[model samples]
Structure formats: structure tokens, C-alpha cells
Target: AQSVAQPEDQVNVAEGNPLTVKCTYSVSGNPYLFWYVQYPNRGLQFLLKYITGDNLVKGSYGFEAEFNKSQTSFHLKKPSALVSDSALYFCAVRDKNAGNYQLIWGAGTKLIIKP
Candidate 1:
């Protein structure tokens, strides 16, 4: 079975500080890891993906993630948070052998930025 857990319900940050939303996953085979962001009433937008090779992958909106295989974790990060950066985030994983290519998604973590 494949699954993902986002332990935090929400993350609160100042407008210009660093922020992180935790995520962990379990999968049968090599996993295709992804991070996505969603604005209210909008569909998720692809932030980044880790297929193979690099442990540290960078993506849109100045976000990056570190893939920790031993811990089965992939945590999202940013050098500086923005007020506009406040949004809902989801971590997803797909099995390499799964025929449908459907992504197993986390519930989501709401990021709140204070002015």
C-alpha cells in the first residue's frame, strides 16, 4: 500500500520568514514524489517533483524539498516566506509500477502568513 501523511494541520509564519510543512510517505516501490500548492477555489499547481538522483530538488515560487529515503520523508522548505505564499499545500506520491499513474495525496497543510 502507498500513503502519505502531513502531520501539521497548518503552519503559521511571518511575512518574510522561512517556513516548512512536513510530509512522510510509504510505498511498495520507488516513488515519484511531488509537491503542489492550491489557492482557494483553484486546482493544485505543480511545485516540484523528485523522480530520481538528487536528494534536494528545487521548484517554483522559490520552494525546495529534501528527499530523505531512509526516513521515508520529504519536507518542503523556503528561504523566505511571503504573504502571497500563504496557501494550502499537498504532498503526493505515485508508485512506479502502478498502472493508473494516479497520485496519492496528503490531506493538506494550510500556510498562514502574518503581515
Candidate 2:
């Protein structure tokens, strides 16, 4: 079974300092990994993804991620944090053979940024 684990229930960061949200995964084949951010009462917005190339993949809102194949991990990172960046983050992976490409999601990590 393909799955993702977000060990942290919440991450608190001060506005302007760099931040990170960790994630790990287990899957049968090459996994399609992704990071998504959700605001209150809103749908998830795509952050970044690791499909087939470079380990460090950058995405929207000055966010990025590193895909570690050996460790089966994909951890999201940002060089600097923002108060507006505070939200819920979810890590996901898609099983290539699972037909629907629907992502198996993590429990989400709540990010809190202090001003």
C-alpha cells in the first residue's frame, strides 16, 4: 500500500525565518509526490511535486522540496517564512498502478507563523 506520514501535528515559525515540514512515504513503484497547502474553509493549493527529475523541486509561494529516494522521503522547505504562509499542509503520493492517480494523503501539519 502507498502511504505518506507527516510526523508533526503542527509547526510554529516566526514570520521571516525559514521553515520546514517533513514527510515520509512508502510505495511499490516510483511515486509521484506532492505538497499542498490549504487555508481555512478552502481547497488545497498545489505547492510542489517530485515526479521524475531533480531532487530539489521548487514551487509556488517561495516553497520547495527535496526528494530523497533512499530514505523514501519528500520534505517541504522554504528559505523564508511568512505569517501569511500559516496554514495546513498535506503531503501526498500517487500509485502508478492504482488507476485513478488519486493521491493518498497524509494527516496534514498545521503551520503557525507568528508576527
Candidate 3:
């Protein structure tokens, strides 16, 4: 069984400041982690993924995340935030144990950027 956790229901940040959205996971073996963002009334847009390779991965819209094996964390980050960046972010994990390819998703984190 695999699972994802996004502790914060919302994150508040001032425009131009750095923002971070935390995520953690639990899986039997190595996990395939992903990040997605959803606007007001749109579908989940693929942000980035950690299939393998370097721990730090860069994704769409200046977003990046660091994969920590020991801590089992993949926290999303952006050096500079923008008002347009406000949206609902999600962290998901593909459980290899499951016969079907279904993503175990986190509850969600609503990011609010203040100008």
C-alpha cells in the first residue's frame, strides 16, 4: 500500500517571496512521485516527476522539488512567487504494488498568494 500526505490545507505567501508546499509518501519500494497544479476550474496539470536521477527536479512554472529518501519527503518549492501561482497543488504517488496504475493522491494544498 502507498499513500501521500499534504499536512497543510493552505499556504499563504506574499508576492515575490519564496513558497513551499510540503508532501510526504509511504511506499513498499522506490516510488514514482509527481506534482500537479489545478487552477480555478481546470484539470490537474503535470508539474514535474521523480522517476529517477538527481534528488532535485525542476518542473513547469519555476517549480522544483527535492526528493529525500531518508525523510520520505518531496517538498515543492519556488524561489520567487507570483500571484498567478495561486492554485490547488497536489502530490501523488504511483504504487507499484497495485495491479492497476492508479495514483494515490494527497488531500490537496490550496496556495494563496497575496500581493
Candidate 4:
């Protein structure tokens, strides 16, 4: 089975500073990692994903993630975050049991960006 986990319940970062949200995975083979951000009263918004290719991938809203095979980590990052960037973030990976490679999301981590 494939799975993903967000180890932190919340992450705090000051505006303009870099921020990272941690994610770890447990999978049999090459894992597909996806990151999403959810604003209050809004659905999730796709950020970026690591399917295959370069280890560092850039995505929407100036967000990016680095895939580390040895560490089994795909952490989301941004060089500088804004106050509006504060939201609930989720990490997901492919579900092996599903025929169509549906994603199973981990618990969300609240991001707090202080001005």
C-alpha cells in the first residue's frame, strides 16, 4: 500500500521568509507526490507534484517541492511566503489498491504566516 504523512500539525513562518511543510511517504516503488492548499471555506488547490523527472519541481503560487529518495521526503517550499499564503496544506500519494491510481491524502497541516 502507498501512503503519505504530514508530521506537523501546524507551521509558522514570518512573511517574506522561506517556509517548508514536511511530508514523508511509504510506498513500494516510485511514488507520486502531490501538494495542495485549502483556504477557509474553499476547496483544495493543486500546488505541485513529483511524478518523475527532476528532484525539484515548481508549481502554482510560487510553491515548489523537493523529492528526496533517500530520506523519503517531499517537502513543500517557497522562497518567500505572504500573509495570504497562510492556509491548510495537504500531501497525497497514489493508492495502490485503487485501479486508477487515485490519491490518498494525509492529514492537513495549518500554515500560519505572520506579517
Of the candidates shown, which would achieve the greatest lDDT relative to the real structure? 3
Ten residues in sequence with the least summed lDDT for candidate 2: 94-103
Off by over 4 Å in 3: none
lDDT of 3 by residue, 18-48 (tens): 9999999999877899999999999999999
Question: What is each predicted model's overall lDDT from 0 to 1?
Answer: 0.94, 0.94, 0.96, 0.92
Predicted candidate 4 versus true structure: per-residue lDDT over 1-115, tens digit per residue: 6778899999999999999999998887778889999999999999998989999999999999999999999999999999999999999987444557778788999999999
- Candidate 3, position 40, lDDT: 96
How many pairs of residues collide in each model?
0, 0, 0, 0
TM-score of 1: 0.95
Best by TM-score: 3
Model 4 residue runs over 4 Å out of place are 95-99
Q: What would the TM-score be for candidate 2 when compared with the true structure?
A: 0.95
Q: What are the C-alpha RMSDs, in order, of all predicted structures?
A: 1.0, 1.0, 0.9, 1.5
Error of 4 at 61 (Å): 0.7
